[model samples]
Target: MLDRFTMPLTHRPLASMARYLSNRQVTPDQVTLVAFLVGMSALPLLAFEYYVLALMAILLNRLGDGLDGALARLSGQQSDAGGFIDIGLDFVFYAAVVLGFALANPGQNALAAAVLLFAFIGTGTSFLAFAIAAKARNVERPNFPQKAFYYLEGLTEGTETVIALVLFCLFPHYFPWLAGLFAAGCLITAATRLWGGYWTLR
Candidate 1:
């Protein structure tokens, strides 16, 4: 939901960084792979109960998420394959964080993590499915013109999810409650995306 605003604010800085990296011959795909690897490190950190360290790793992953896209555009190397890699790994990373929580304390967090993962299916499918149809129809998302594909606006977007994850890491004991709340938001996003996408497509 807040992505529209946050993206523009980060663009300049990310662009500058992208330009520097581009000069160094760094490719977007390379940045993406490194980011995913670093992000995956959070799983072990979380498993070992290093919440603060895990949080830092997660944040770096998120930063790289943005940076890769910026680098792609800056270096004029944006490709469907690159975008596909970026988004696909994103869902994996998001779910991995939840799994990390479950692994950290299975008795308390497993069920909640499962529920959140289920909710993710709803949001993820709705987002990707609509993007495909929208792209077919030449539908545009002015709010996210930089995006590789059109997507429905929703209550639970990348920004909100990151905030929820940050909170989860900061207060691991509250994972169940936080996961429930975020999962509920994902449901809302899914419902709205389904409804809005249907009408918009028609």
Candidate 2:
């Protein structure tokens, strides 16, 4: 839903970052691996009830995530391997954040957390399936901007998730409510993607 405003911004600094990283001889794969490690460490921050620490971890992880693409462009080393690793790490990191919230409030929020996880898994699966099919069919690959259907729409993009991360850190007590809202958004994303895939693929 917000992609129209956000997509243009995504590429603005990428080329500049790519130039810098290339000059430094940084590899895209190396950036991806480092990003994955930072993202994985976030799980422990959440488990230890350090919401602020987790928020910092989220930002660091995002930097790593963003860097891989920049590094790829800088090095002219973009590939299926690089893209696959980047996206795979993204899904895992998202799951870990939700798991962190559950760990932080297991007493009264476990159910909501579980629901959020289900939604995440379901919606993520739908998204990847559609994307893979679209790729196989030689369709114009749908960038997040093109996906009026799922993932990029609603309040679940990187920006909004970061905002939610900040909110979670500030009011960890409100985790349950946030989880429910995220779950609702996930459901809507899933349905929209599925329907869009049918129309586009058929």
RMSD to the hidden true structure, all candidates: 0.7, 3.0
Per lDDT, the best of the predicted structures is: 1
lDDT of 1 by residue, 1-202 (tens): 9888777899999999999999999999999999999999999899889999999999999999999999999888888899889999999999999999999999999999999999999999999999999888999788998888785789999999899999999999999999999999999999999998899889
Off by over 4 Å in 2: 142-155
Alpha carbon lDDT at 177, candidate 1: 99
TM-score, candidate 2, is 0.88
Candidate 1, superposed: residue stretches over 4 Å from native: none
Worst 10 residues of 1 by lDDT: 144-153
lDDT of each: 0.93, 0.74
lDDT per residue as tens, model 2, 1-202:
6555655686657667767878888898888888788877778888788877788888888877777776776577877777777778788888888888788778967898899889887678877787677667666534542231223234455666666667776788888898788789878877887777778778
TM-score of each: 0.98, 0.88
